[model samples]
Target: MAKAYRKDEFEFFQNQVGKIDQRVKSYLEVAGFEKWTWVYAPVNRGRMMTSNLAECINGKLKQARELLIIEFLEEVSASSTHIYSIYDEGKKYIVCLDRSPFSCGRFQLDEITCERAITVLKNKHVVDMKPYCSEYYYPEILRKTYDQSMFPMPYKKEWIVPQEVIDEVVLPPKYKRQPGRPKKNRHKK
Candidate 1:
């Protein structure tokens, strides 16, 4: 489970962790780990706790700014003595999930375009895009969702697609009109 940080948590942790937050967030951004679909899953070790430990180091350094080199060296040696013990004792794993730094919310797609996107996405093993219409989003699912007569694809296999599908599949949501019953003409004798 992820920990929800209220104002106090963010403030307190940020202050205590100092430069750690900025550094970590910057690193994550550079690594392209800035999407909602991007998850930081380490089987062990909480990064937050690591930041907190680094914070402790920063705190000691803050206090010893005037200390002699010999004294600082001794403190550094002492600090590193049991770093592994601190690491091994953590009871919970910390995983961070970043959602949507790579948004594609307002994108559109058509039948042929969507199939091509799906094929490309399947080829890429994954994709992070939003289909503007439900029809274009899930062609197969939309088929099941609506009557086949209402929404039919022209091509059965190898969805025909040009380079620009998003532009091609742009349509309004309202197409249903109560099936619009056909009228019969009455002739008078």
Candidate 2:
């Protein structure tokens, strides 16, 4: 029901859900169709139709999560023709290689070529995706960021502290730990 892009499609799924469980259907209705159903949504959600964005991202990062930080960074360092059509997971996506804003919304939002754009770029035999990325990620820009020399701090006794700052007392936060094994996974938002 959430994936349906047309009223008829949405209605069909809605009926199916109603048949399975009227209570679920009523709950969905009470929550508002616009909140969950694509057809009723007032704004474009792009290709992100999943119920939870964090879950979707977590799924995509499942493999990378096990890798070391440097290895993960290396993997992350790894877009497109004028336009192309892509089909994945029973959904069709339009990727615009020549400009900003692909159907997935990632290209425009992150200022980086998304997987769809990258596929289009590969099909078009285009190399060097650096041009598709934002200037912030450029080698020159990154180099400029740390061009200045960074010095280490002197001894604590050499520091000039403000009277108010020196007198201020900092306390640890009061937290009651739950009685159970600590969770290895991050808390979902």
- Please report, in order, the local distance difference test score of every candidate based on alpha carbons: 0.39, 0.68
Best by TM-score: 2
lDDT of 1 by residue, 9-109 (tens): 33454455446577765554465422321122233122121224455455546656578999887877765532321111342211111111111111111
Cα lDDT of model 2 overall?
A: 0.68
User: Candidate 2, 177: how far from true, in Å?
Assistant: 3.7
lDDT of 2 by residue, 18-132 (tens): 9999999999999999887666776655433332334433444568878899877665443112446789778777765445445655544356677877877887788888877
- Give the runs in model 2 whose Cα sits over 4 Å from its true position: 1-81, 179-189
> Which regions of candidate 1 fall more than 4 Å away from where they truly are?
1-35, 38-56, 85-189
- Give candidate 1's error at residue 140 in angstroms: 50
State each candidate's clash count: 5, 0
Q: Model 1: how far is 26 from its true place, Å?
A: 23
Lowest lDDT block of 10, candidate 2: 47-56
